[model samples]
Target: MSLRRTRSFALTVVVCAAVFTTACTVASPGSPSPVASTAPDAALQPFYDQKLSWGPCAPYATTATDRTAFANPKFDCARFEVPLDYTKPDGEKAEIAVLRQKALDQDARIGSLLMNPGGPGASGMSALTSIVSGGIGGGPLAQRFDLIGFDPRGVGASMPKIDCLTDAEQDAEREKTFADPSPAGVAAADANSELYAQRCTERVGTEVLANVGTRDVVRDMDILRAVLGDAKLNYLGYSYGTRIGSAYAEEFPGNVRALVLDGALDPQQSTIDRAVDQNAGFQGAFDAFAAWCSQQQTPCPLGQDPKQATTVFQALVRPLIDNPLPAGPGRVLSFADAQTGVSQALYVSAAYPILFQGIAGLATGDGETLLRLADFYYDRAPDGRYSNTIEAFTVISCVDEERITDRAQVAELNRRADEVAPFRSTGRGPVNSLDPCAFWPVPPTSKPHVPQVSGLPPTLVISVTGDPATPYEAGIDLAKALDGRLLTVEGNQHTAALQGDQCTDEIVTQYFIDLVLPPEGAQCKLA
Candidate 1:
């Protein structure tokens, strides 16, 4: 991805599948539920029955750039109202911001194609703009379907935004020493977690926090489908968005026209298992980066030996634990920051050169480039104001997974993580030393389970073999769970579809245009 594209891509924090079965009967929309009752409450029919008034995309309060971007005439925006709690439909209501780009070929247009760009907290509206403006995959998918994007509850441009800390407070928090695996460190980290949760509850209200899990979001998606007059939903979700897509298929299998889930998240994995898997994945990506760096005779920071590259990289970052390097006038690069910077760059092969330059500078005791990378990961603008990405990410994750409060268990997980990905491990622990969920005000309502969905239209699940965020095994598991066909992209990027990979793009386009399912175990090699 180019720098422009990377910036447009959501800054997802890396805190966070299977096989095929026999084809089941496809259920059409308006048919009896194929799955159990996980849909929106029928009592809230007014909200579902409400009509959308499309107009110019409204400006978000965060930035002028975002405001201007949404003002593009090519995009039409609207707001959808949903209940704060599906269980209490008569209670509070929230507004969901939605955007749409009309299909280029109106005569041959398919229904609206809903898209989500991971983050669980990423702005789908922003993602839509990027896809339409970036000419992604030669815009074949866009030409065939009206692209629909919306912000989930408590996310960007949505009502009741999740706000925990001020920019200044977050800056100070980020600069704090990351806790080691010792008892004292764990205690300190736990205290910070408690403080974070307390602040969030005080700032964002407890009611909204309680309801932002995947289950609620899935319900909201169904409502969107109904309101938009789509008999069946045609959808594409990436990263954390895969969870949303999987849950939708699980709950409303009969309502799917077609779904494509890239960078699949195995719904059945434990929190520790996920963390460990990501650790190993990032380690693999790091090795790939080092090997690539070794071959470059000119701009290569690490010389022509993989082992030496690893040694040098380790030497450069090890000191950050005890003594952080000065990065800028007032900014410093801590061990956590260094780890975050390297991990951010590993998201795409196009970013390897940036990682090389950053690492090379770090080796010479210059931390400027690495700090910039870290800033990008955290979505901290130059002015120091941060987006609510981290805040929303924490709340959604905590509510989706069971809380971890036991110190001993956390320690054990950290030990395994360290062994698996020593270079990427914070040295402090597996969980962010300050495990936010440990002190989450709201307990998780959902547990890890396979989406036992059946009778769905042909869905495509794309998995990148070396994706650090969502591993390949999870994708296989998801495909199996949904009984959907699997398309494997042999690459290290997080999501492969429509990222200029011809094979993956063709498969995805065909699925949307003609409802075609690629052959079982189809593989797309990265260019």
Candidate 2:
């Protein structure tokens, strides 16, 4: 539901690759340049020169819909090996699970097109199936490049994954309302952060957690490029995926062939600023949703005055904190579930109907719908098992963002979240609650900076005016920082490009195929 996005209420909706070749021989197997080397201490020759054996995929789906999509035989999976710690390539290693959908027009195939959906924690393996179903890579785009999706280090289907809370524990944690800022509430929040941090450190140890950040993932990506026989990288990245692409551009500008970055995160914003900006984005999206709900539905659950939307919406769901609502047997909807479900629905305007119905049902004391929405957000299977997306998200965010250990700063961070996102905020007074990153096992690796990558070809950055996860200005800022062109989308969603927006998709397809840059300030609206 967030991008380390602090939801204040439910909180955990934090942010949340591959190669293919027809010859069946080694793809590229070339070593990285000195600047892009795995480490100065060790050369990455062994890791880059390895061959990947693509075979029938092991199941990556934990839910019914995903299972159906993944079962299609069109997919071939491979496990690519990379060092867990780049400094010690000869030491412990992690296996990145890569999935490939072979190009339909193999005769005209160009190369492999690697893709990532922004989750920092979301499963690239899971996203590929959805992308294929939605025809993102199917038509002309898929005909040329083998569409690839890989679960980054410690993500879905990857070896030595980051594991923390059990399914039952996760459920229990979600049931509790989290928007209080009182001293006792802050203390409890700190303790919970400590618990989560210690569990991660104990289960996967500090080294793996430390190495699972974006920098590490991009390194694995380069190795994948080498192993898959691609001399240059053709990539599509969304949301946090944009971060990876920009980082790659910064680290290895010469290796890029084509990159399409949509819903970009401003690389220069600090972690707290990024999270807070995202919170504001959500509130803005929520305002749009509330206004839309008023027009589209009878009696407008948000009431006649759209300006009063935040107060009305809060009145609707905030009571779930003390008195939970029944959803289905063995389940009840807490305030955490209500806000999470709403936030999830706000990501794409297409799902607004479901959101309206859920809120309407909530007004009628039926929370099954909203509860289901929250379930989808958490990836909770019917059997009550969960993927390690959230765990990996926290671990990656901790290492990627500059650490915040100061109590005063944390209090300010909480206050800012409440101020900017009162709809999602508890409306409680200023208070300090330690972020899970405060108790992280290791220091951060990446800091906020404007990426100034020279010698990079004209990259395309797409931003939507109403994007709630990675705001519109971030896109403008990122495009300027990277010296890339910006394609403006007039919409209310997370990402608009390459997701069946005909005009936007055509522009992206043209860019990827011919390396043609969109005109400055090119704009499209979702049809």
Candidate 3:
């Protein structure tokens, strides 16, 4: 089937250690400075004092393909020890899996360019390997610096990985039928969410779950910088990864050499605010897709009238909620499954065609295509095994945000979300009515606050005007908070660095290579 192509970045694609050593105490204009007593407790001196023993990356590979890829001699892997709680430096510890692809020209290497691809749960190691293996565009940074990627604690390949549900359990959860947005439905959804939290707490333990917030990850990044012997950190973060970069700057302003935060998340926004904004953004993207579909020849999958496209789309989805269509031998397209599939496709304009095909297939009584999209979104492999991303995302997100136990507030947010994205918000009432964190075993340790990193060099913040995940407004807020230059990409996509846009590419590359900052209010038109 033909896929609809668009200018948006693909969403369904691609998916930290510490030490205390003398390298940690080295104070330079670009080195992390000592914080006040109220700040996060510093890592134990031994953490900074330890040295990494880098060797073959083969043993750390998580998949057969990854193992084969790691066979390349140039890629080196290692594990570094980090304190579980910075406050308890000498207490329990965790190991972070690290991957490094050395610069091609060692003599001209600027330094290590650390990267995080977001998810707050996305495996940075997988992201880096994909780039090195040419799965994604690496741009000039690949040649200029040693590309460093490490799975944050409680993440892939890292010790104490968050494994809330077994493959079979997760499959059952994903395949469970979702009820419509009635009171009973909402109650059932809440019960399911609570059950998920209980399982995570029971299976993963509260100790590691309590410490997987952005602040902890930022601390880990600093320790990484120290161990890598880089006086300053050169970093790139995408999606939720932007939060890491922003938080890092807040915690260690002096340690930042050059940072690029694409698809920026606003640090000050509440969880409800973020959900509302994202819903609105996705609605806008859907509208764009509908409008585009209307321009197609007669019998367009969504029909000729763009105005009725949303109605048509809703008609196609509503039936799934009541009587899910058979997607395969044993799988069916549940309302929740269809929603997730559509949401993932909306991330990048390039996937529009595939979405169109999937929707068209669904319209014609074939649910297989759309079901496949949902599986991809959930990172479910063909064998029915699931990645730990969803579990990790939930755990880390719960610890980072203020817990919401008030039913009234949740109901209010759900109402507002429905208003923001009517068609897409249909059966989501229950999904949004309760906070996923409410059932978390541990209470939140952090709260939303604007990052206040001072004395940092000029940082570059990229915001795509029509981004569905991290909206442009959040990017504006992030840039203003960091006092960084904002490079706006006037297009529909999530994150715009190194995505084949000459203008965006030139601006970012110049910032990283020459330490140049774009003038205030710089904008790159979609090409």
Candidate 4:
């Protein structure tokens, strides 16, 4: 997990709101901003905006004993209500749950540091424990800033659950669909996409999907910033959260005081392009993992050579498409599930041990472990009653990016991926196709907006060279777009801030503490 500057070719690789408001009235494009927008809702926002007693803030204190240790140690819960629809301010309202760990150095507190875990749907509230525990970016800077984790709209605790399918049904459908990218694969892909669309439409109905987008949440963030009394927002966002951060900067660039976007994504790319790029990112990470596994073949199960290991992994994927492994009741891993597992595993090198275990298990007579790995990708729990992120992830994504209106476009992308990454291209299409948004009841109020972060505060953008999720190229692109600083980590994974790289962590800590920017092209060495 150590981070270091690998003087190599930047590791190249593949690869890769909301809001609230006091107003009940709706606004349209070119219309004046809502009057009561800055005001808190008398009904919901008041309570959330109210000062906390600082008592029993950590509702999960009981749950934390069995969990990881906290670095800053304090935890409190607060709820803010936001308009379900930003345009229709008077529409139905929803609550967003927030978790706070007040700065240890209260006298020198530097305002709230909002942390996003980035499922677009990831649970920031749960992520508080990690932040407090110093797992993310070492938590030292946290001593001067209260850490705030809010489950974004449609995510955990925030109400109006976005869950589209029960764990069991989702598993069954996945198993029945998703094959390799052959003729049979096409049929399976179509069936899977149709089933996914049907299931999501049946469960979520149509209205919820349309409302969840990056812009809504960004506005909600502004509301939160206002309620918190901070003149500007200090944010640390990862994965999809980077997209959220970028959108916020675009819409309210003036409000960005200090922002750290790790694992950055370029906002200019369409969803289809993002998917294709992401697939490439994973392919790069997998290639790196394969190389590492080859060097450590004594312990790894795949192979002694990277190419051999990939071949083995590809063979493993093909069979799973034909005969999926069953995990818990009503749960099985499909080709798509397997592909997603590989992608997710590549995001964190720590998952390599688990992937190795799963690969070994599959190579033997058991595929349950690998199947469980797939379960993690789908975010399914043993007892079902899903995490609410899967649904939210889909909804917000669709709102921000237009759907694949032409199936041929998807087909072409898959074909192109096959050219670049023969084994990894198949799943990006149908396996990771759009469902929730296709049937979303509402239309986007605005098109995608990519912000130009010039003349802004000195921002620190971190890109791990081998990051398989948000490609390093994105970090480069974003750093250029933001006209800020970029720190490159020579590692094979996703976000580097939390990975055990002392050098990267030190740079981040210094940036937050000193408010200084790294020189252009500054790189953190791998340990």
Most TM-score-accurate candidate: 2
User: Model 4, range 8-81, lDDT digits (tens) per residue?
Assistant: 11111110100001001111112122222234445445433644334344443212221332223456677777
lDDT of 3: 0.76
TM-score for candidate 2, residues paired by index:
0.91
lDDT of each: 0.76, 0.79, 0.76, 0.62
How far is 307's C-alpha from truth in model 2 (Å)? 1.1
Model 2's C-alpha root-mean-square deviation from the true structure amounts to 6.4
TM-score of candidate 4 versus the correct structure, residues matched by position: 0.82
Using lDDT, rank the candidates from best to worst. 2, 1, 3, 4
Q: Which is superior by TM-score, 3 or 4?
A: 3
Model 4 regions lying over 4 Å from their true place: 1-73, 134-139, 180-195, 198-202, 297-300, 326-331, 425-436, 444-449, 453-455
Candidate that beats the other on lDDT, 3 or 4, i.e. the better one: 3
Error of 1 at 84 (Å): 0.4
lDDT per residue for candidate 3 within 445-523, as digits (tens), equals 7777988676877788999999988899998999899988888899877787766677887787777766777776688
Tell me the deviation in Å of residue 222 in model 2. Answer: 0.1
Question: Which runs in model 2 stand beyond 4 Å of their true positions?
Answer: 1-3, 6-42, 59-66
Q: Give the range where candidate 3 is weakest over 10 consecutive residues by summed lDDT.
A: 16-25
Give TM per candidate: 0.90, 0.91, 0.90, 0.82
Clashes by residue pair, model 2:
4-15, 16-119, 17-149, 17-150, 27-228, 27-229, 28-229
